[model samples]
Target: MIVVLSAVLLFGANIAQAEEPLYVSVGQTTGNLYGLYTTSNEMWAVATQRCKDLGWKNLVFIKSADVTSEVYDLMYEAVGTAYYWSPIIGMNDLDNEGRWLWNDGTPVSGYTNWGPSQPDNHRKEDCAALEWPFNTWNDIDCGREQPFICFQEPSEYKRSQIDDRLFSIRKFDVEKGTQEMARSGCKKDGFRLAVVDSDAVIAKIEKSINWNSKVGYWVDGTHNCLNADNCEGSTSYVCEDVFPLVLSNSREDYTVGNTIEIECAGSGVSTVNVKWQRQDGVPTDNIWNEPLQKIEPGKATLIIKSATLEDSAKYKCSAANDIFSPSRGYVTSINITVHPEAIKDAMSP
Candidate 1:
């Protein structure tokens, strides 16, 4: 009887074996790794929490318009064997009434995959799902359970995408801030203040700024100087043969009070001149700079604060004298975007 019971127990254990999880690599260059989950058709809310518990940042959501095709294929492969209720994205009208927000804290702009007049918010349906047809987004009830797509670190792919566009030679305007401040801000977000040496680039930059109705960007060019034309005889200098100073405008992200820093990417930190400037083409009276906070040689940190909407803008870090000769300075910048959730708390005095 004991031998027979042991055999039955072993057989039951085999029957309960779990299926192997499937893995997919996204963003050919960005290399975003994801795991497809199909253990059960758990509630959208429950699956979201489970994905986080399973060691992922959040659901496999779309960040850019160009990613729709890649995401569609991944979802099709994931649901091949099981016809479960797994959603590929984490989006809902949970916080506000009509607007759907992404789990990654970004706007869901550009590409969409709504199933023909769907997302009617039927029965107060808030959660998004990729149902039987696959490749389409459906606004379903959050209580409904489904398998989901969970992804690893997303900032890597986001950063890589921005890095690839760095040399595009367009007028990469930031929201606001002076040249030095913009330079520092851009480095934090994986971009540099653009270096425009051609009239075509200047025209493109000017058009973008005017169309957006925002202040102009501080490029690596003398103010008032446009395309071999003394033009306005700008006071700014542009050195051609100066040792290039690398500035890091990483990922352009921060909470209130976060220390925003920009450092020299290479040599000449000891004698380099670094300053923070804003977008209005002015260096004085900016909000981030402290009158008494002794500026260091290699890097400068600004404690971001402010409750108003106008607080978000571009900042540039200008390195001159040593590498920037006779006023010719190569500059870089980053845009400082404010977090909607953190804004109120950050602005609290």
Candidate 2:
């Protein structure tokens, strides 16, 4: 019975292993044996054999499905050990220096494995490596580029079709209610307002009104009337589609203890409400009780006598009216830092 049970367990493990799919090999290049891998969908069997003949170990395979087609194509063109002397390019090494950075210039935190004292800065080495036993990196000289392996895998392509019968209605010249337009416009587009086909148009119109109009109004696209003859002027408008809401001015960043001025602007917008609150940690209830100052119709200013670390948070400005929903609401954040007297004195008064 013990022998039979052991055999059963071994068979089960083999089955599980077989279920795992084999990854594809796309290309091979040489560098400082940086273990970084990328993908392409195609395989190059000849290149794999050549690497084996060259006694190259630690082959890194890149799965094509894991990356964009453009990247895959680049790897496919460079198959074999001939490119071994060339630099092994990874997403983080685009600009070299071994410091992997995102396209946005943000330093990629974590995901680093380096050999102890490996980057020893020997003679200003800038290239990096992914060490074995653990995939870590150490900066090395680019001149020491070595060979690397790449892989690709097949993927499925699934295309979805959308209905083409949908149409859109846009306000051209004046403020129009979004709710009314959505209801009336869907019928002409051969769909209902509830359908997904109308969501884009509805969102566009709502954002426009929310950013542009101070007065709230409802647009019913389902309305069939040619003009405002049947529409309720007090609650709705048959006005032509116009530009969406726009910010009156640019936003400026501030530190604690600094006064801030916020402005909201749009064609039909007037009064705006300004609210300030903390972004994280405990919320303060007394902020509202402080005397709020209004600078002008659609403008407000907050004066911080002496800003504190607790003052760091986000401020919101919303402009609205009865004819339309809040036309525009803008958010700006402030960061506070406690500067030492020496640093503060260094600044020009």
Candidate 3:
């Protein structure tokens, strides 16, 4: 009883049993409850499993920015001035040093709060923890035992799958996440990661989804920046190994001198560029390609203007990106024909 009193004084609040939701507040979801429980000298691995079996006690690996702030406060109240685990959840460069990732193998979204001179990789330390004196991150060895926190994951923001050219991980749980989970998430929806390359495509994606500004959106720019770094200046999140698929068809017919249009199906919701070529290998130059999209029902439109007899040919449209190599580019064959004016008039009746 005396020892418990001292610990509560140290924490500035009475320490409760780990199973109790002492600080339950409105979280991203209904069932989520945040708590920092003392393990009385349990190692990371032991604590992880014990917590899971006890309940939904996955080690709290926070990713949401807004949630992080609220959690910092909750953590302060829970631990007062003590170090606790953060799960600094992300991919670790097992092949290389100084690289990290989210649990799903997607790069950590954005805004990492590494403690000063932290991630020093000291003694091969890989996992992260919120160090005391301030809940900044530090890459620490995973074997050490200490009281750890199990907090709620990122909030489930609404996502929209647009035009099979771009995809976002919808309803992802921080617990038991993998890159395949994020990638295959798009796969299940018949899409892939929306690769960011140009300002136009970037702009289109921004317009397509109502991404929570409070949280960082995962936009990989390995080729868009094309400077070796996934990002322009400091590399943040890099693209994953997800390739888009074709979900729609691109075949159309029209009268001579009339506008003919065809839309290449997207591998999934993502961004893509389509180039048209004649059956005889002549690139069609009279076509205007632009992204016509909306969130209600995500779609990208491609248009061929003022079809003429010369436009009668089998055209090919392929979507390509560097995320997946060997250029197994998704191909769409469009057969465009200008109905003879006589035939058009005859068919009009």
Candidate 4:
């Protein structure tokens, strides 16, 4: 009887565990391994140590928009189409107020995808995270608990080859100038209008300008220099590139007996094989055998009709082609929780 009780306990524990894949290999290109932990949420400090305990270097450091886009896509694939507070990043302004810095001691500036008037420092929020759907940066309270993403980098790992752009600031004799005048002024000093490209340049520009003067400067770019455009009427303008620097940057519920559908799509390649899985904590046995219907050439849908409480588990969708393996595929997921009571009430109505 005692042996039988042990066996039953083991089986029950397995049933309680999440059945979806939580970690996907990003491959060796970045010289890093990435993992997303969603089984439980943790605060900022606890989560930081959690990554270290798991042999990760730190929380995923977002050094560029490309990195942001890639991680965002990964989150979308792994968590499905519901709103998530998301994987806590390694950015904070703990030492200095308004002086945000990455965990690696890099200042936060330039090419920021901040939600409208974000990082307002609401309630002394020092930590930073990427909000879902919009994929914008937000300052979060470090004490808040949330799922986190971790990256493991080797000791010999180096920064990416794409360098950050830098610039020198030139304050005009008279504050507030026209676009052409700003350009001419910069050209006079053997420089063109300041092309604000990276965070380093933005820091320099902010430091050189007089915030109290309320003067405008001419900057060459829009959307924080993601594209080329001339911004007029600024106190000071920036010169050409001086050097290279580096910098970085929710859920839905379901009722029981309802049909659940999730769409998985892949781009950048012409064709892809999409697969769905339930996180089982094992390398194998997670491959979901549910038949997927190809909604489009590179897209597929996972549908479960008349869902039950047994379907309440994290589900992941992966898309891959010949160029990429399932481990390095475009993946997304949706955590579904079915409510038996809600379903029953709806059925009664």
Q: Pick the candidate with the highest lDDT.
A: 4
CA-only RMSD, every prediction: 24.7, 21.7, 25.2, 22.2
- Whole-structure CA lDDT of model 4: 0.55
1-349: candidate 1 lDDT, tens digit per residue: 0000000000111111233234343433234545566656678777778666655567867665435544543543344324444464677778775787787666566666677787799899877876543456788888876677766555634323211212211222333334565455445433454556555545533332213232233446445333334322222221111124455556565554454555434233234455554443222223233211235665443334342344467655544433211122334456766556546466555
Q: Give the candidates in order of TM-score, highest first.
A: 4, 1, 3, 2
Model 4's TM-score against the true structure: 0.42
* C-alpha lDDT (0 to 100) for residue 82 of candidate 3: 35
TM-score versus the correct structure, for each prediction: 0.37, 0.26, 0.34, 0.42
Preferred candidate (lDDT higher): 1 or 4: 4
Ranking by lDDT: 4, 1, 3, 2
Give the poorly placed runs of model 4, Cα more than 4 Å off: 1-21, 25-32, 153-349
How would you encode candidate 3's per-residue C-alpha lDDT over 1-349 as one tens digit per residue?
0000100000112122233332322232232335555535445566566546544336665666545544544543333333334432322444457776643455654777677898898888766666654556777776766666554332321112111232222434353434345445545544543466665555444443444443333444433332233322221221222333342554465788886655444333243344443434311322223222221222234455666787776555444432221112344445666787778867564
lDDT per residue, candidate 4, 53-104, as tens digits? Answer: 6546778787776566456556655564355555688888999999988788
Task: State in Å the error of residue 184, model 3.
Answer: 54
The lDDT for every candidate, in the order shown, is 0.47, 0.32, 0.44, 0.55
Off by over 4 Å in 1: 1-20, 81-88, 132-134, 154-349
Score candidate 2 by lDDT: 0.32
What candidate 2 gets wrong by more than 4 Å, as runs, is 1-267, 271-280, 283-292, 305-310, 320-322, 325-341, 345-349
Scored against the true structure, residue 2 in model 2 reaches a CA lDDT of 7
